[model samples]
Target chain A: MMDGSMALPFWLDALIALLLLGGALVALLGSIGLARMPDFYMRLHGPTKASTLGVGATLLGSMIWFGVGHEGLSVQEILITVFLFATAPVSAHMMARAALHRRVACRERTHGEPWDEMDRLPGYAESSSSSDSQR
Target chain B: MTATVLPIALALFSLSLLLNLYRLLRGPDIIDRILGLDTLNVNAIAVIVLGGIYMDSSLIFEAALLIALMGFVGTVAMTKYLVRGDVIE
Candidate 1:
């Protein structure tokens, strides 16, 4: 039996609605950034950061909705939030390195412009132009 | 119980999925595309969770768990390959 007051149902619904709204807002911001960012590395910041949070909030909202609806406190919803925190960065790192291996170049448009410049590391060819643009 | 909320959440999640699709298509670089795929995976998890909510079934939670566990492994291995050219040292 749900221990909380009967009024809790209304509260829970309100909470879920707020969470969904927040998640949608975050998702929207990520999409905007995806379109607005100028370079690959800059673009990486959008979905990895914002979309992850967006999905997390949305899933968490769903989890709470169902858990409370069923009058159970199971935390199964946390699985995605935990997974996102773990996987998103690793994937981003991999993609960034792969792009580098392909000699993917960056645009010097963002605040942290150091990555755009070719490093003097051994065994890597320095390209004067962004790789994707060249293609 | 609020009957309409489930359908609304489903619709919103699908919209998010579409946004991720746009990234996959319009990415200027390969890594941007990979990032988009990662976003897609997370969005997929959200959809599964929301589906569980709508159906009042816990089975979807198990699938969500598997995705959570394996997705991390897949991403780590892929990232390792991208960085060192091999998943294992």
Candidate 2:
């Protein structure tokens, strides 16, 4: 395992190191944001944006590292990247919808009127009355 | 030289995972916890890939792929349940 390092040139090693470190740090920052953000809506932004990019970078690094040494391109790594890029936003949207339907409280600093006619939307019938009671 | 950098990457990823766990445990709302869980799975995939690199094996990549698939489905199901108050409907 260790002997593979000799096969890779120093600059390639540096590129991999940079990609791995950068991705990990961004991911750590996203998790930090998730932990630190005060409200659910604010917290949603963190992992959705930073973590997606983090994993994408890390996967790219893996692809490059494996591709250079292997017989051809690392197609599996590409599949993960594509899958993540497609799903991350969709999950974030669903989570946000769930939060809204549940009437999760938002921070005062949040500027938008998220509640305006929100209950009229599908799957939110029960929440409209509850929203009125909570106000 | 390449071997020396693997540990640092692993440590950073571990720290991120710990932060995600804290969010999962300390959530003031269910959505927050769900968000934590979603992030956790993504980070886990990254960690698995890094492990593959460290171990010099293509086999671990299969595990990473499976995780990515299952994690997305799980997140979507959980979020749908939260939104509609039911999974299938």
Candidate 3:
């Protein structure tokens, strides 16, 4: 079994510890925000922004730990990291769109017109109007 | 020292998982629930990775990879359904 003797150097171990701690802390905070935030959109901000970074840091720490301890470099953890980073924003955007389509209420302090009006703004295509009405 | 730290980190991650579970249960809207589930998926992946570290196994890394793939697909599919009122049309 692997033990402290098999661990990386002092500084490297410290860095790994810091990464794990920081990642978990950020992820915990994101989950806390999801639980505590006032509205759906506000809650959406937490996991998408913070948790992505948290998972990335944790994966980095894992890569470093395994790379140093094993015979060769470790690259598999990078797949999860890249997959998460690429997909997080996309999922967040889809969730926000879904929330808007469902007419989920936003906090009163939130400014500007609802998404329906902004649909006319540059990128949303005219064809989406049919789907908008279906909601 | 490194051996000791792993369990502490694991406990902290478990706490986060509980927090996510609370959000998932308490959601007043479907989208909110979906968001909670998505966050839960990500946190679960993190937990699995930490588990791999603790056990010093490469096998768990593949589990993490699978979770990442399946979770993203599930979230996207659910969101698409919500937006279009149909999964495939």
Cα error of candidate 1 at position A23, Å: 1.3
Q: Which ten residues in a row have the lowest lDDT in candidate 1 chain A?
A: A123-132
TM values, all candidates = 0.75, 0.89, 0.91
Kindly indicate the candidate among 2 and 3 with the higher DockQ.
3
lDDT of 2 by residue, B1-89 (tens): 55777788789889999999999999999888889999999999999989988878767777888988998999999988876566884
Which is superior by DockQ, 1 or 2? 2
lDDT of each: 0.68, 0.85, 0.83
In candidate 3 chain A, what residue range of length 10 has the lowest lDDT sum?
A67-76
In angstroms, how far off is A87's CA in candidate 3? 0.5
In model 1, pairs of residues that clash are none
Error of 2 at B58 (Å): 1.4
Docking verdict class for candidate 3: medium
Better of 1 and 2 by TM-score: 2
lDDT of 1 by residue, B2-67 (tens): 345556766776877787788889887656666666677777787787676667666678787777
> What are the clashing pairs of model 2?
none
Per-model i-RMS = 4.8, 2.9, 1.6
- The residue-level lDDT of candidate 3 at B88 comes to 79
lDDT of 3 by residue, B1-89 (tens): 55667777778778878988998898999999899899999999999988988878767788888989999999999999987877878
Instruction: Single out the weakest 10-residue window by summed lDDT for candidate 2 chain B.
Output: B80-89
